[model samples]
Target: MPTTGRVRHAAPGLGHSGVVTVTGQLGEFLRARRARLRPEDVGLGALPGRRRVTGLRREELAQLAGVSVSYYTRLEQGQSVNASDAVLDALAGALRLDDHERTHLRELASRRPRPLRRPPAERVNAMTLDLVRSMENVPTLVLGRRTDVLAWNPLGHALLASHLDPTAPERPADRPNVARMLFLDPHCRDLYVDWDRKARGVVANLRLIAGRHPEDALLASLVGELSVKSPEFVALWGDHRVKPCEGATYRLRHPLVGELTVTQQALSLPHSPEQSVLVVTAEQGSSSQDTLRLLGRFTVTS
Candidate 1:
């Protein structure tokens, strides 16, 4: 891809403005992060003169990012656009950005000039519901493309969805979003002991999803709402972090059975691009396993 050119916008609307804003914000973020690091961080020779700034100068960053000083400057100023992924990666390396920052840079560079809004949420298919049912013993849940908890086995409902009203409709409008529940639900905050870490992880996963589906108005709206409601959520979102939540262990304090540790994994449904199944399990013979068994029994009785 060529390094120099202006990106063409299909129409003058929120989409176009969004792209420009994304690009400008990304450049500003990179510049700010880079300016905080010292030359020794990336093994560059120290300058003799008194340095005015803390980190690499713009010219030095251009040299490190492998673009012309003028071009890098324009990118930072939002003057030149259409940055390719390769260029962004190179710049990320030069800036010594961590994994989260690198992903953010790529996302910004790859953003479409005209982003589309997500359409209405569709109903989950029968087969998908059946799959969740089959995993009844395990805490299994089916999440929509926007990460809405569309369907879940009883155990899953008992484990995660318990934060929301059990009688709430399973539609996007009424359904409980995992991210929202994690931040907004008082029970969720109490359930997860390391609430801050878990909160950021949720935001980062949403960031990755948002980049892939930038036109998704529902996803954008969810993010926007969380940002306003939770100051911690707002701080993490502004960091421009990104990640896929494939697997992780979570400790939950169940009201009925006390504390339990469970390893949660996300599995993509082969037939549906808009659905995924999340399963949670405890290691055999562990105390957490006992708690899980007790919880399962309670669910059965209830």
Candidate 2:
């Protein structure tokens, strides 16, 4: 899974990208997430004068979370590293964080430095490619550690992202991450009927991965790019939630198929925890299953 809820290292703050001390990241993520709130929205009484600052001020956030302003300021400033579960829970509640966001916050608070590893090759191996091909009727994809689309079966491409160039998965540099596509790509954006719920799931899943692979620079870069490009993503990331993306049923408004409900299941590769196969299907004997079966007729198996 994944999260804005990534790590603090020498990570550069929002806007300007590239490596910087991650020390400031927790604060930046907290500040950014907090900036989206309003006083009345959280049941705080409105002030008398013309308000200059946006969202809940740091002091207000601290107050709402049941902590002193100075300590919360320290935490936001990256000065406080001894965050406890109870404190994080309180803070998450104050910020209205979901389960995934809370996990991200915990991960951020507890991060320690490790030498960055050689960036992992995101290419799909021959065996994995072969396995994908074997699943002719299944809408399946091999996802890299960061959820990059490393490989896809013909039905997978047609059923999930037909609008995208089918060859995208072949290029490591240009590979598409399903999470990014969910928010940034128009076709992907319109695919899911419950957009907000889907978005939360994506963020939560990403947050979980962030905790597991803190030293992955590419993963960090993806989060940064998304943060800069999508305000919705930024807000969701700040919520610091984590979700294990095992399986879920989604109602999709597929452009070609009209409407369909499908259950998505992810199976981790035996040798590679970093990658997994995601398959989508409708219930047996259901009309949605009939529609899904119809999609296979148009599958591009080249």
Candidate 3:
């Protein structure tokens, strides 16, 4: 049985060696970036003419992060591969990395590369389809690990992806990944009021997903497309920011139902690691709720 859980993305450019895995690439990437940063960059004054290496010595960084020098060296060499989230956090602080770099570090350290799998002709299960069909009142969507819209309720189609051709969702070749839509789609760009914040979150979540599934060709393609189409996404990707996403308040300016404030929740299934069910709900009695209700009615009628 396929693991029914939200898929996590691996750190970018980590694939190399015999496997081209993110873990190896991440190790090399961190080593290179760390070597480029001078002692001055992290507020340490260089000792004149005595330093052998280009950047902060492994020992020095280990001292700052309060870890053993040998352990840190192993990490740089990709020998000590398994890293806890807390250790990654400590390294981020020791390196004086900004928010984006820190997130990237975590992604590189934590994400697992994907396995080769035959693309299922039908990925979404019948039970999931039934569940979405039953949710006529709330906007619900079933997304594959690659961010493909495998299934959605009618309102979900209208609320989240109105710009996509109706037939696109049903066709694997034509379908749009949610991450791709958020950054590459002009309509999606204009849908959110806080586009920048939303973009960061989207990129961060992508980072998380990429960390976990480095071999997913569909995901890699989506990343490549967004990198080419959206400069903001490109910049963010370069910075290597990453974060796990949960329920969050989002403001959407809908054309038909007017503006609505919604809380988006992602629910993962225990058996499927590559799938998640996301639902957007409005708070009770608020204008946003009224707006959502209106949108729901309009979507159903249409």
Candidate 4:
């Protein structure tokens, strides 16, 4: 019933230094969420006398979720692996997690992390390539789960990474990663007018992906490389922010054409949860549209 000084997880496979394992992430998330609430916020009256803990204590949270304190404590300690859907739902309700956070909670509590076993190239989708080829005038890209550029239209190459090889995405071994570019590439640094905002959004999307697939080796490598290469990325990743890579407006400072603003939309590939089509376009009738049209004068055909 008393609040412990801090909860410690005992799950195996924790990485060295700053890498957060699945179980460690789960416990930290729970601790962080639990510490942000007040007893009064959840209809519990503040107890008299100086309370040593913030938010709902472990016992109080367990009671609200209809679980024994010991059971909930074990789950937080990463000792429980086969948590039922009912218990997860109860905890989600008790924690008041939104839809995205609820999904994250379920994934983190599911079981031990295991690498996805598939062909080396399963992350690449042929149809995604065909789709990007059709988007001749649009800056279109097909991104792997780890944010690698699986495919990109000529316009996309010109608009986003013209300084790099236009055919970089064609070679599996030499694919250009947008996230890596966002943080580590000097050209990419100069491209974004608001680098901080773009960097934060990129890290947030990566956080969501990391929670879903903690055992992805390529993803882990990318994170480690960025953490070492970019202090900005290290700071952002530690924040545990999650965001869908949906649609957003981006202001770009292109060296050739000066500045232009465009909106980017990411559409998940059907039947392939890890691949997404990233397309960027300017608003119709705006100067950005005209600039983009001039910029995308080159086209690619299948």
TM-score of each: 0.83, 0.71, 0.74, 0.81
Candidates in order have lDDT scores of: 0.73, 0.77, 0.72, 0.77
Model 4 alpha-carbon drift over 4 Å, by segment: 1-21, 38-60, 115-119, 122-124, 298-302
**For model 4, how does the per-residue alpha-carbon lDDT over 53-171 read when each residue is reduced to its tens digit?**
87888887887899999999888888777889999899989988888888888878874645322225435566667788788878998888878988888888888998888877878
Q: In model 3, where is the ten-residue run with the lowest total lDDT?
A: 2-11
Number of the top candidate by TM-score?
Answer: 1
Residues 149-168, model 1: lDDT tens digits: 88888888888756566545
In candidate 1, list every pair of residues with a backbone clash.
none
148 Cα displacement, candidate 3 (Å): 1.3
Candidates sorted on TM-score, descending: 1, 4, 3, 2
lDDT string for model 3 (1-302, tens) is: 43222223332453322133665657655665567667777777665567888677777778667889888888877677778777888888877777766766776776565553334444777778888889999999887776788878888989988867766767877876788888777888888998888888877777667666665555665676666667787777765555656678999987777688999988887767678898999999999988888887888778
Q: Model 1 lDDT vs. the true structure? A: 0.73
Which is superior by TM-score, 1 or 4?
1
lDDT of 3: 0.72
Off by over 4 Å in 1: 1-20, 28-37, 46-57, 84-86, 96-107, 167-169
Cα lDDT tens digits, model 2, 1-302, are 32123333222332122333444657866886687789887998765677788788887888889999999999998888888888888888888887666766777778764544437567666878888888888899998878899889778988889988888898887787898899899999899888898899888788677666666766777777788788898878776556778899999888877899999899888777778889888999999998888887756423
Which 10 consecutive residues of model 4 have the lowest summed lDDT?
2-11
